[model samples]
Target chain A: MRAGERAYQALRADIVEWRLLPGQVLGEVELSERLGISRTPVREALSRLTADGLTEPHSGRGVVVATISAEDVRSLYEFRDSLDCRAAELAARRGDPEVFRALAGELLEALEGLTSDDDPDHASYYELVQRMDAAIDEAAANPFLRQAQTGVRLHLARVRKLSKSDPRRLASAAVEHQRIAQAIADGDPALAIATTRVHLSNALQHALNTKELAPVRPAAS
Target chain B: MRAGERAYQALRADIVEWRLLPGQVLGEVELSERLGISRTPVREALSRLTADGLTEPHSGRGVVVATISAEDVRSLYEFRDSLDCRAAELAARRGDPEVFRALAGELLEALEGLTSDDDPDHASYYELVQRMDAAIDEAAANPFLRQAQTGVRLHLARVRKLSKSDPRRLASAAVEHQRIAQAIADGDPALAIATTRVHLSNALQHALNTKELAPVRPAAS
Candidate 1:
């Protein structure tokens, strides 16, 4: 891989995984030295990260990871409500039925393992949701929409860390995914849109409630 | 303005205005010389344009302007239907009533001048549409949604050149904008979404027809 791309992927993974917390300063020289690369590639990667809204310029501290407030979460889901619903509708209209059918079956199977107390199952369920998202984007066959959806999902990934421990939310989300998959498999655009709306609304509520009870940042090291 | 920003604005204007035709190779040295800037800034500008989907990397040709097919127009409108509707709905809920009321009045006045033979009026009508778009985005007040909408509008600008000569289309579009503005002014989300849907459907039809009739490119200069 190209050095810039490698740096981008590494930095992006760190940010998304919350290994690099929000508001953490990312000095280009420090990152270049730590990653064993030249400053050029690190600078390029930081520019891309800023473009992706993952980081922002600080007056004197270089770039810092962007923080997600409750308001940001609310706005993110509101935007997702439009994007996910449209994606599901388009996927139903243009997607391969067999692909969605297989996905529906997989989602159903995944739901069976999603108990309220199983942490591993919740992790796997999130993975299944990501797969479903990819399948829907593929089925939709619109590059522009996919690009927009991808941008929103990047932030959604970061926000997911704020609510990942809720088992009940995981279980309900699994059922919601099943409904969306089945609707797409059946080639029902309206049903797919409706189900997606429900899923996004439920997910937003859970994110908001979880955010209310949890601290947004880790204890200072 | 910064050199990169200058290059970006100049190149973007060329693309949107069709001076830089789709599929035309964008040689870095040539553009830098023409724009009177260094290759570094021109390169950065091209990179930004690529991110905007206005250009793409070719196998042997470096980067060339991206082409829009009939299918691309279809897909663009399908995505716009979702975006414009959501933006209008949000604007209705959150926007300033007086702003839209004034915009609606302006649209109504523009409609009066949009006769089939008056080309200048048509240009002004399109500008009004752009202002209304900006106002609605401002009212929606979500930076993420605005960003997504702005990306889509970048391509939409290129597509507009494909169908700008149709006076009847312009007149009807003016009326449609008036309705959307009025709905937002009245704080009716449902009405705003409904009018936006109508406008997008009409726009898609017009673009598809225009693509069918117009040659995708001009003969060699």
Candidate 2:
């Protein structure tokens, strides 16, 4: 991969992981030195970030990490609720049963470990989600739908990052995934969609609660 | 607004309305003269278009107006269905009842004026959708949802422009809006979402069918 591409990927990961929290200054010279790249590649990476909505362009000079408000979370769920339901519906109808079965097995294995964990943070389930996302992508049957999912998923990542660690919630979420996978395996499109919607609504409500309890973002300086 | 802004707006409108078909070359000099602007503003406008995903950068110079493919259409709808549903749900839960009632009134008025020979074509209906969207925006209390709606609506413009023109479809659509408005007005969140989903599914199916029937892009020269 090119130097610019590497910087872009690294910066994206940092943003998604909340390591570069909202409104963090992204000085080109500092980032170039940190990533061992020249200012040119860092500049290109920032441009890409601006395009992705992860960074806001400064007054013709630099960029800052984008901010997310409570309103952003609400809106993100609204998009997620609708898109996930439709994706589940299509996945149930179009996805390969064998692939779903394999995903279910993997998900079940992950859940088995998480269920025993007294405290499982977002990191524990990250890989499991990638598997689920791959399954959803394959089942969606429409490239446009997949692209839309990408945008929603980005927003969801922020929401998930702030959510409090709750074993009960993790268990319930895993169960919900199992139900959705079962519905897909059965070719029950309506059931799959409905199950997915319920799961998302509950998750969204949990996220909202987490936001309420967490310290509010200090107003932008 | 500068000349470049004017050119961008005019070109965007033309493209959205299918007045300028896909693969149209956007020559900077010609567009500059047409909009009474210098090439600098035109170039700036093109840069913005590249960011907006409405135009693609060329290998050497200039840009191509965006053209949608079957794949693009499907992906667009997947995202749109999710965003629209979320809009409907939020509109029901948080939007003012009066807003929905007013939307109902406008839709009915439009319905009353409809004539068998006066079917609303894609362009006209596209304008009409703006009114419907205004209602959704007013109802959705979140800015993120609103911004997401804008993205989905723009992409939907292409698929919508391709849908077959039938008085029946228009009348049916108006009726769907009436039901959706009623659900929102009544504070029936589930009903509002369900009705909106039905409306979108029908519209998407219609659009997909029309797109499939439309002649394939003439063999790229």
Q: What TM-score results for chain B in every one of the models?
A: 0.90, 0.85
Error of 2 at B136 (Å): 0.9
TM-score of every candidate:
0.91, 0.77
Model 2: CA > 4 A from native: A1-7, A25-48, A56-63, A115-125, A163-172, A205-221, B1-11, B19-79, B116-128, B162-172, B201-221
Q: Relative to the true structure, how large is the alpha-carbon lDDT of every model?
A: 0.84, 0.75
Candidate whose lDDT is highest? 1
Residue-level lDDT of model 1, residues A1-221, one tens digit each, is: 88988999999989887889877889988999999999878877887898899998887567998887888888888888888999999899989999889888988887778763455646677787788899999988888889988888888888876565766777688888899999998999999999999988998888887764235573252
**How much does each candidate deviate from the true structure in C-alpha RMSD?**
2.8, 4.8
Residues A1-221, candidate 2: write the lDDT tens digits: 88988999899988887888777889999999999999877877887788677889777568988888766776677666767888888889888888777767766877878877744454657677777877888878776566567766876775677777787888788888888888888889999988988898899789888665235452353
Question: Which candidate ranks first by DockQ, i.e. highest?
Answer: 1
What is the lDDT, from 0 to 100, of the residue A200 in candidate 2? 87
**Fnat of model 1, as a fraction:** 0.73
Deviation of model 1 at B102, angstroms: 1.5
lDDT of 2 by residue, B29-129 (tens): 98888778787667767766666667787774688877787667766766676677777877889888997887788777777655544544544554666
